[model samples]
Target: MTVDHTAPGDLAPHPVDLRAGELAALLARAHNIPADVHRLPSGEPVVSVYYGLVVRIDDTCRFWWVVPASVGRRRPLWTSATVPAVAASRIAGHYRELRARPPGHLIRGGYLTADVLMEHHTASAPI
Candidate 1:
C-alpha cells in the first residue's frame, strides 16, 4: 500500500468527530488487536499495548510502538519469538487499513509517518 505524504493540513477533513469509545471499537475491529483505553496525564485517550506500552490516539508522539529486537528471545515471561519482519508487516497493514476508512478529524491529526510505515513494510519483506 502506498501512502500520500503531503502535509497533514493538506488532507481533506473528516466529516465527524470521533469519541474514544468509537475509536477503540474501530481499532479493535480494523486491526484485530485488542487495546486497553485510558486517559493520559494530560487527559487525552491512550491505548495500551503489550509490555506497558501506551499509544495516545490524540498525541502524535506515542502512536507507534517499535517492537524491540529482544522480543525474539524468550525474555522474562514471553514464550514465542517475534520476528521483526512479521511484526512490521502486521503494523504497516493495520495502519493502511485505518487510512482507507472514511476521514476523521482526529485521525487526520494523528496520522502515522510514511517513513515509519514504509520501514515496517520493507523490514517485513522477505530478503
Candidate 2:
C-alpha cells in the first residue's frame, strides 16, 4: 500500500456525491460494464473498470479517471461533473477503444505519454 503524508486539513474527505458501489451498479446496468468497488487504504472507495481504469469521486463530487502509478501521484484523465450513466458510458467507450488498439503499435507523443502513464500506473490496480 502507498503512504500518504498530507495533513488532515489538506486532505479531502471521502467523496459523498458519488459512492463506488452505486457507480459500479450504474456501469453494469447502463453500459453493461462490470465494475468492482475497492476501498483505498485511506478508506476511500473507488471503482475499477476495464483496461485497468479507475473511477473516483473528488471532494466536489466530480468523477475522475485516475491512473494508478507505482511512482509519483496518480494521473487524472479528466475531471468533470456528470451524471453517473454518462460517466459509465464514457468509461466503457474508453475501455473498448483501448482494447481495440493493436498490440506493439508505435507509441508516440500524447499516445506515448498515455502509454507510459499506463505503465507507471496499473502496478497495483485491482483490475
Candidate 3:
C-alpha cells in the first residue's frame, strides 16, 4: 500500500436516501461484489478489485470502501461522490442506454500519469 503524506479534509457525511429495493438493484447491476470481510495469513485484512469495494449504510452515511489488506492502512480508496439518490431510481435506464457500449469498468485507461496535485486542485494541461 502507498502512503499519502497529506491530511484528509473533513467531508460532510451524507445519509442513505434510496429505498431498499433500489439499493439492491444497483448492487445487482452495477457492482455486485460479495462483502464478507476477511483477513490475510499475517492477520492483515484482504482487499482487491474483486474482493474489495464494500458499500455500507448507517444512519449518517451511505458509503463505499476498499477494505485494506493491512492494519497500517489509515483509509481505503473511495469514490469522490456519495451514492446519489437519483442513481438508484434512474440507473436502470442508464444501464439500458449503456448496453451497446463496452461496460465502463471493463475499459481501462491507456496509460498512467503522475499528476499529483494537492486536494481540491484541478489538473492543468501540459504545454
lDDT of 3 at 38: 32
Which candidate do you rate higher for TM-score, 1 or 3? Answer: 1
lDDT of 3 by residue, 11-126 (tens): 43232433223455554656552223233343322222221222333334343332222346544333322453443334333334334344442233111111111111122211
Better of 2 and 3 by TM-score: 2
Point out where model 1 deviates above 4 Å: 1-23, 58-62, 71-127
lDDT of 3 at 42: 33
Give the Å shift of residue 84 in candidate 1.
Answer: 21
Model 3 scores a C-alpha lDDT of 0.32
Name the lDDT of candidate 1.
Answer: 0.39
Ranking by lDDT: 2, 1, 3
**Top candidate by TM-score:** 2
Which lDDT tens digits does candidate 1 get at residues 25-117?
A: 555665565656565444555444333223333222213343322336422111111332343345444445444455563234333333333
Model 3 superposed RMSD (Cα)? 16.0
Distance from true location, Cα of 54 in model 2, Å = 0.4
lDDT per residue, candidate 2, 10-55, as tens digits? 9764555246666789888877878877665555566777444667
Once fitted onto the true fold, the runs of candidate 3 whose alpha carbons sit more than 4 angstroms away are 1-21, 30-50, 67-76, 84-127
